[model samples]
Target chain A: MDSSSLLSRVRVVLCRPSHPGNIGAAARAMKTMGLSRLVLVAPRRFPDAEAAARASGAVDVLERAVVVETLAEALAGTVVSVAFTTRSRTYVQPFRTPEESAREVLQALQAAPDTQAALVFGNETNGLANEEVWQCAFPATIPANPEYSSLNLAAAVQVACYVLARTCEAFSPQAGAIADAPDFVPVSHEAVEGLIAQWLAVLERLDFYDPAAPKRLEARLRRLLARTRLERAELDILRGMLKAVARKIP
Target chain B: MDSSSLLSRVRVVLCRPSHPGNIGAAARAMKTMGLSRLVLVAPRRFPDAEAAARASGAVDVLERAVVVETLAEALAGTVVSVAFTTRSRTYVQPFRTPEESAREVLQALQAAPDTQAALVFGNETNGLANEEVWQCAFPATIPANPEYSSLNLAAAVQVACYVLARTCEAFSPQAGAIADAPDFVPVSHEAVEGLIAQWLAVLERLDFYDPAAPKRLEARLRRLLARTRLERAELDILRGMLKAVARKIP
Candidate 1:
């Protein structure tokens, strides 16, 4: 599908996954592209030891995964369904490429805000049967090397994720996209330095630091402030607290 | 721990997390506050059915989690480790509140760049044992509602994530921190108005605006530029080009 239609409101469904690792990887793939919903249908081993280990720290996804008995159960009340398949079939309904399928799904999503759209993939050994392919409005196929189109479950998910992430339009900031604008009032370098100086003055008055000694105390305070990157409001609060401390010290 | 020492250099680690979903959620929490580098010790389950479903879209973190076989493996080279435990210890090394613990971790991270410090959390059923707590330099207890401290795994992660995010000094543009003053130049509203007026003059010369009736062209341009809070350098470039355009307009 075109880039704009792949993000925001799509769910990736796995039917009878034999290996839990693939489920974990698929979840990871979905997250990288900002897609979250994952539905599993009749998995052999779920909450399995191997799956959790492979999922690494992504335990949240596993805890929330919905386990079901059948594809129909998984697709209950879904507005649109797109099936991912490798083999071409002449008897069944026409299948669209991933791009075309994504476009269709995107249109359906826009049309029906309340409805859910699912992209379904079958198990490792054998893919969805003829009936399952026919159940989908359109089949979605990933274009790969013609010589070897055997894509792993997670890899396929990643491809779909990449396509969808680019396609969807959302107001949220893109990953690593930093707008170079002065939107907020900044605590200027000069202001921070002044605050530090005032604090040092108080320390001196209280005889907390030896005047003859090296400027280690000032350097330490500077480093602390610099590393924290304190905001204007935060700095103001800190300065007020320091002043209070100074008042009590005398 | 003192406030300065409490917040020096901090790392948050999840131990034996049973669900991948929680891992994904944990990553989301960490990313929201600009914390990275998650370590996973021998989890009961990984890459499983439930995790992918629950993580929603935070898969990148799952993909990047450093998986290890043992707690020792996870803590191998770290200079300090804070085990998150809910259970009270009678005779263990001193325990600090989450605030104090967070401060200490933050300090360690800052004091010795080479020293790896971590805040470790145990499994779902039971938290880190006394022996496990003793493995670390200090024990950290989160001050929750007195009656209920039974925080969900992801919720615990979220709380720790928030503390680290707040305590750390890294100024992210996304977080609206003015850490890197050198990188940006602020542009004022008046400067933007001046540029627009100059542009309108050129448009008038080019007969782009109707003389008989005023069009909404300037309004539209203003709307577009208003959304973008330009840096000082950007304003200079735009104004410079506007002047060059005005010189050539005749």
Candidate 2:
């Protein structure tokens, strides 16, 4: 689940940026969120003095940034193109809250494991064109104040990248501990429900309770079962015992 | 849960900043992420022209920034103070995931709803002193590539502010939509366990199943409860049913 490798697959694409300074700031923003890939689609200025100056110490991000002639060129090999749109759009496009969008991004990485994804941002003043928004499979919107929802392009990138980084499964001391610990992930609800039905059959064969007066017994059992937080392997073991007991009966 | 109001209550405190440019960049970084309150503690240089140049158009954020003599003064009126550190520490300060720290910061805001909180970042070169870190209740470390993890002061601010902004409840279109949406929070696991123990007591008397051959039954039951993800009211309803069943058995 460690996502640093997955994070490497995420490209922060700034489309047709007007200000060199915003480009620089966006580079710094990307690095902070552990996102290094910066693909610029026809930015008005690149390799500009203003950009280098504004990049602060994250000049490396700018230096390594990929500048392409067109948005299509920028998203060449990318699978999921997510647009970071500011204004409300009449255009039809799949949308998700930034948090949920981050999850989707992670899942994309999880699904392919090696394939890449792109997060596209439109120009500062104009935002995304309807055509550009439609090009994306997913569009993520940041929840800012409606009255003054003026988030700078770099800031929008910062928020999205930040959520992606924060949501990432880091292989740090904390994540390492969680992985090493025996707190195995619990089994699904469907699996547990199936196990419960099987157990009921075994109980009926054993004459444990009169089936006619089972009043609240099954519900009580369900509630008790719900509390254990059982792992998949533990569920398997329990199911095995149920099968064994059922086989013993006539 | 648009947290713009809650964000304003956050004080981004920098202790002993050596460079004025970093202060400016940090201000810009904060503003991008919707965090404006800045407190400089014993900075080596303040109100310098270099800081203004670096701040870009976010000088308004810097113009309104606060400067104090000590970290204590910077943290004035702040009940929950978090220190951001880079190096691994053997010290006993409580550590939290940035996500968790943001939650704690939000809770502090909720506890008072009007009072301010602080996220304290260390100096550019040397980071916070041991004594300074101990002053804060929680400490959070960003998971970065250890090989070249020399994140600039402004970049650190950018990451932290981005996380805070992303996790906030903004009054924007998407935020309103999320707030209006019903996503019920489940009851705590401990509360579920206590109810199960009470039910087990009655089950013993009712001669439910073979007590001698528990046979992973209790384990299976616990798993089922965990899967239910029961709400408090549902737990209450089930507990009432358990009591009724116990009475009938006797």
Candidate 3:
């Protein structure tokens, strides 16, 4: 479960796969991307000759896959559980993309290095049911053709693996040249709000806010600042500049 | 639409989507990520009441989506077409991860100032079929759990948009604060290849190859050089060194 170790970092969990071919293809896809850990939850048919044949040289992955009866058992020890859902269920929480989910997973891994994480995929027929999605902390969805949004189960695994691999590659330990000198620390939401409030006060003092002038002025300011992604230091500087301007106004 | 005006742009394309709720969720995903453009190709059911209700507040993306019958139509006039696939199709060439694909898309947009570009996703049942994947210039595949790789469609779009947004945010128009004064242009790929070949001849004369050594040596050399991403001036210096070594060998 060590975040630093490549193994035990991520576990791919399929709720219930109907086709053996998908399991095989999923294995192949995982191997191609340098990922091997796989877990199946009550597969309709696994260890089938067809799946083994389709798996190519990834038979090892198939051999090592854990078969469990329920999702709860599969995710028992995992710190983060991300459910893959195609539709937004009435009661299920909203979704994030695999990339965003990966970031979250990475953060969780860093925060609690011993906790394992699982990215769960549902059955082939209906996908992870609403109940399954609700069990997870968040749902991740793949955007597909609105007319025909049916992606093969294995393909979903491939996408998730690709995200993890790329993330690992982009921020590889060897590529940690910037780690020593962190240029900008992200400003917390509270800090950003404080800056905004300060700016608003200055604007109010200068009579900049015209009640009837615009409907979305505050909203626009929020959007603009969100896009900037200012660092804490940068926000502090802006606050100082605003205070200086306020002093001059007197 | 002018691609330049679409700077820091994001286009959300859905292919063969079956559930209307998914379409709505996709719109919500786009809106959350600050992406406005949404395109749909041959959706099974759209503008469904369920989709609008699920969209929460991102109805604008749904209302504005450009619906088309075919993937080709959706990608018309696009300078760069990136197909998001989870399965490795027999027909299409190797795929890049979302990050690499996004980099290419951004680069293509910058290179061809006015050209339109698109990121296409496939159906839910079967991601961009093999033929569809081949139509794209760049193929992006996500990495998932090998055992059960089922990712919800909207999540794929979210990942794509997230990478695009981050790339746009990270891009620095200017090279460095203290731009290196214009120096000798770097040698092109062809020039580098020629220099490497000449260096190989010198090594050959020095008995550096023991019949099987050249292959390994060349691979190591390629890996070392590829890491540098050498500019014109840097390449010139390397070529000059190679030429000097080659002359001395005689």
Provide the DockQ value for model 3.
0.02
Task: Judging by TM-score, tell me the better candidate of 1 and 2.
Answer: 2
Off by over 4 Å in 1: A1-9, A170-176, A179-250, B1-250
Off by over 4 Å in 3: A1-7, A170-250, B1-101, B106-250
- Residues A87-195 of candidate 3 have per-residue lDDT tens digits of 5455435567667888888778767766778889998778888778878889887654333445556666766766766655532323322221144466799998999
- Rank the candidate models, highest DockQ first: 2, 1, 3
Compose the digit string of candidate 1's lDDT tens values, residues B1-250.
2322332234567777876766766665554444556778887677665665555445555667788876656665565567777634442233455556666555444444444667788886677764555455556654432223345455556555545544443322123221222333334334566777876665555455554666545544553343333445555645654454445443
Off by over 4 Å in 2: A19-25, A48-63, A88-90, A171-173, A176-250, B1-5, B19-21, B28-35, B48-60, B165-168, B172-250
TM-score of 2: 0.62
Best by TM-score: 2
lDDT of 3 by residue, B91-184 (tens): 2133566667777666655554445567788887778865565455556666544444455566566556656654554222221222222332
Q: Tens digits of per-residue lDDT for model 2 on A16-127? A: 9999988987887777667889999989978899888767667998999999988888888887879888647754655677778888888887887668889999998888
Error of 1 at B71 (Å): 33
Real interface contacts reproduced by model 2, as a fraction:
0.17
